[model samples]
Target: MSRTVAWTPEATETFDIIVELIETKWGFASAQKFVRTANQTILTLASHPEMFVTVKGQTIRRAFITKQTSLFYEITEQQIILLYFWDNRQEPIL
Candidate 1:
């Protein structure tokens, strides 16, 4: 069964910043495409939450790269939580 998804305040802020930056650097279409791909990744994770391996015994999920950014998330029985939107050039937080 599909699980519910939720974004923490930090996650929401991170996503907004990424979208704004993408729009400023590229264009609305590019930002829109990024958002669409990110959403699809979340849905895919929710449907098959087990696809991600645990990190420090926590379910830390990483999205396949599209362009320069990567989407990271965490999943639990009650919630599929977005952890961060990371730029692939930089090291992951955790």
Candidate 2:
């Protein structure tokens, strides 16, 4: 069965910021492409939530939507919560 996927407020904000930057730096077409790919990945995750690798000790998982972008999420009995949309190029904060 397919699970439900929802984004946390922070993840939504990250997505908006990234999309806007992509639109400005590249074009609407590029931004649209990114959105489409990301959405499809989310939808796909619903049915195959364990398809991605775990980030570490946490139950949270990381799915690479693109070479530079990743979708961080956690799954529960209730729903799949998207934690963040991360830019992998940047060094992770400790």
Highest lDDT among the candidates is held by which one?
A: 2
lDDT of 1 by residue, 3-83 (tens): 988888877887898899989999999999988988887888778877766656655767764857776777777778887
Clashing pairs in 1: none
The TM-score, computed over Cα atoms with residue i paired to residue i, of candidate 1 is 0.83
Q: Candidate 2, residues 1-94: lDDT per residue as tens digits?
A: 7888888999999999888988999999999999999999999999999899887677989999999899999999868899889888889641
Model 1 regions lying over 4 Å from their true place: 55-58, 65-67
Best by TM-score: 2
TM-score: model 2 vs. ground truth: 0.94
Backbone Cα, N, C clashes tallied per candidate = 0, 0
Candidate 1 has an lDDT of 0.79
